[model samples]
Target: MTLEKKQPTPTAKPTADDEIDLIALAKTLWDGRRKIMFYLLAGAILGLVFALASPKEYTANTTMIPQTGSSVASKLGGLSSLASLAGVNMSNVGDKESLPPTIYPQIIQSIPFQVELMNTPFKCPDVDQPVSLYDYYIDYKKAGVLENVKKYTLGLPGLLLGVLKGEQEEGALLDSTLASSLISLTEDQDKVVKILNEQISLEINDKEGYISLSSRFNDALLAAQVTRKTQSMLQDYISRYKLDKANEQLKFIEARYAEKKAEFELIQNELAIFRDRNKYITTATASTQLEQLQTQYNLAYTIYSDWAKQLEQAQVQVKENTPFLTIIEPVRVPLEKSKPNRPLILIIWIFLGGIIGTGTVFGQELYNSVKERWSE
Candidate 1:
């Protein structure tokens, strides 16, 4: 009875390998503190240099709302008003656009669109005279220390390849108008386009149904000018596209109307003359001839009237399809630069350097551990 009343002894908890490994890792990092510090310091120094050497860039933005056409319900309401002016029932005509407002961003990305924008003259901070994007970037552009470093380091292979190939003759410059239609581009022109594309961007907000055009450049004035020009060109392009079909229809109808009216007038004059000449003549042939002239005149008059009405409708259609771009936020020259976030860049570099240094330390430790085990 006395032995059964004795309390049972408690078992001791087993030690975890994870806790030991964590302590060992902490010791290893502490031992390699000097190496890690060296890397961190180097990273900070490089970051500082890059931050100082980085070129300042200004960001210019413009937002606009595209008014394609009136709503279908409201469109019919205005048709009556338009019909009174156009002299046709425009109610049956449906609103149409070759490219909708949502496709506007794609239009801006087009090669022809970018090429046109590149050639447009803008004021650059470095130059006294206004220069095109191509001229400024290629001829008058100055490379910063950071740019040179990137060129010599990451882009070294490409640079070597270009050098080995040697310089080639420049391509011929074609007519700007012809180039747009043909989409012809020289090597240098293509290069400039790539650069320009990087500088400009278009963002469309579907929910709000608005567009934002942005341009980033070294010069504040140039950035704003490019953004404004891009917006204007896009709007103009869309308007012209929408008007193309309507305008063509109007021209065709107008031409036919003019032709029919001329025929109608000639027939009317002939009828008048025939009536005057055949007056008091009681012959079956004379009566038949007068009836034929009267019939010809009536047919021509009907055709001419119908064409004239169509001509009016075509004109109204053109006006209806004309797109209106309302400026939600107008482009403005940036007072301060938008890029070269120095502090952020420095932090990133330091963090990257620390990671590399830690990796190096762990790598060395692993190699030594393996070598010692193999030797044993």
Candidate 2:
């Protein structure tokens, strides 16, 4: 039996079915392309519309490096004393007590600083045409959010009105609204002169030990005024803190001076008595006693003079109110607007639109697939 080697069974060539259905996917996309394009065009149009309608905003930033030595340093200086009292490790306590750079930033953003700004002349240049900074913040010109809220509530029926009357809410609301309006109106005039005090921004970079102050208004001059006034306000705050120390020193000196003056007056009286009692005008013993009295008087007079000088110095220093804060850079009026970044806004809108459009396309495709299978 001459059997030729059996040929291996022939395998069939793979059909396109074994591969991914890329053409079907392409067709699906092609069918949905009009809808996708429409949505993209709509998004672009809306973005353009917003860009046109948005108000132009300008930003002015001033940077300041914090001083190396501050009040906190002085407060934490005598750590050894605290450590001894607490019976803890001086190093740990001292380290713990040391004020970090972050604290200054927090101070910059604190309510005290905000209240101080409120009392000063920090105007917002963005919105104040004739309105004050406070008014601009509250959006008082045309149906502000608060006004809208009130109008909406008032439009609602009986229950709200009853509640308002029952709680004496109407009076409180009127007072609040009136106060708000007054704050908006008079913010410019009540500056302790004439500048609004509600539009200062304090931005602190703790890592860099820098602070940036900013303000806004319709008038460039007003913005500049606010910036300068804020610095002055900070100076005043520092002065107030040291005012007590100056007063204390003054009081101490004054009290001692008064005592010395009284003693000197008594010595004078004693000298006069001695003169009156003694009949002899040229007695050696009398002369010697007079010299002793003169010496005592001179000593008292010297003490009084020293105390007077100290009191004078304290008063002068107190009046000066200098705390030695260094201004790294002064604030200047910003020429350019800093808000409503058009390119950034466009990018964000485009990105969000693309995501939404893609998701919509996928969702529709899934729904169509399920529907076709159900019909089949």
Candidate 3:
């Protein structure tokens, strides 16, 4: 009993089933090496084809600081009344009444803005003169070899549907005529609008109060040109919104001034004609008529003069309200292509292939294991 008690208890070692078979795992991978290599080879070939086939693009961007009328008013702190005249609220220095920079992105995204951009003329290849994007897309552009292949292969379903349903005709989609109150977009126009939306972008930094407007295109010159155009349009739109109320007031004043001028002229002419006709007619009727005409003339003159002054002030207000979108970094032709990172694409495809191949090998292993157990 003493001898038996002196013997040490045996420690249980890990079972084969519980332990990771690293050597077996390596062997499994090694066995599927050919399959993995095939996938890798296929991936590399596809990546090379895609990289070569992809079109090149350039990005052009302009950074701007939105200097509103309020900014100007802040600089002229001495003139308290000047701020009010300039449509700047002294209490709130940011000119909150006007459209904020956040909404500027939406302005760029608007259908009207896209349509206007598409209609703009630019120099094109093989064309002697400038041509609009709409005309170029519809009339001049012919699909390339790769594009045709894609159209027939990847886009074959849509093509078949178009043939069966009758392809929608592409033509002038916008009506600038006064007769049409509603703005409608046809398929062709919608396609272009979508492209425009993708090509153009506006990023605003609220804290710093700055904006970045950018455009991308296949042509470097076109990318820069479009970016410049986009900047101009954005500035114009924001300025228009900023001074909208001031401009309306100016118009009202203008109309009133015109009417008052006409009335004043008529009254003056009547007074002159009456004086000329009755040069020496001295009677109660004549005296009363003269007095009344004189009164009318004075009243008209005063009103007309007041309106004239208001008209001038309103014009000043409109001018004062105009904002400056100070360009921080002007757009320039991009020296490098922005899209189709070939090496990255190739690496990604190769990595994806490796993953899929490893998964397939493991899956086959799992299926065989399950089948063996079922048969047993």
Error of 1 at 231 (Å): 1.3
Error of 2 at 127 (Å): 10
Listed in order, each prediction's TM-score against the native is 0.73, 0.54, 0.70
Q: Which regions in candidate 2 have their CA more than 4 angstroms from the true location? A: 1-23, 65-131, 135-199, 216-222, 248-317
Candidate number that wins on lDDT, 1 or 2: 1
Candidate 3: worst-modelled 10 consecutive residues by lDDT: 71-80
Please provide, for model 3 over 1-376, each residue's C-alpha lDDT reduced to its tens digit, 9 standing for 90 to 100.
3655576545433445335477678889999999888888888888888787777789998999977544322433443353244343445332335566778889999989888988999886666789887777777777666778988999999989988998554434544573277667777788788878888898988888889998888888888988999899988888777677567656755775787799889999999999999999779999899999998898777767766766676677777745468899999989999987989888888888888888888889889999999999
Candidate 3 whole-model C-alpha lDDT, 0 to 1: 0.78
Query: Against the true structure, whose TM-score is highest?
Result: 1
Clashing pairs in 3: none
- Tally clashes: model 3: 0
Q: Looking at model 2, which ten-residue stretch has the lowest summed lDDT?
A: 92-101
The C-alpha lDDT values of all candidates are 0.79, 0.58, 0.78
Q: Per-residue lDDT tens digits of candidate 2, residues 1-376? A: 8989998654533345434456766776678787777777777776776665555544444656544323322333453353244343334322222133345434444555544555443444445445544454445434434335556787566557756766443334457658655423233324312322335567767676676777655446666776676666655554554576556656755675687678879998998898899857688888899999888777666655655665676578568744434678777767776655777777666666666676678789999899999999
Tell me the spans in candidate 1 whose CA falls farther than 4 Å from its real position.
1-16, 70-98, 166-181, 251-310, 316-323
Stretch of 10 with least lDDT, candidate 1: 71-80
How much is 343 displaced in model 2, in angstroms? 2.6
Q: Residue 103 of candidate 2: its Cα lDDT?
A: 51
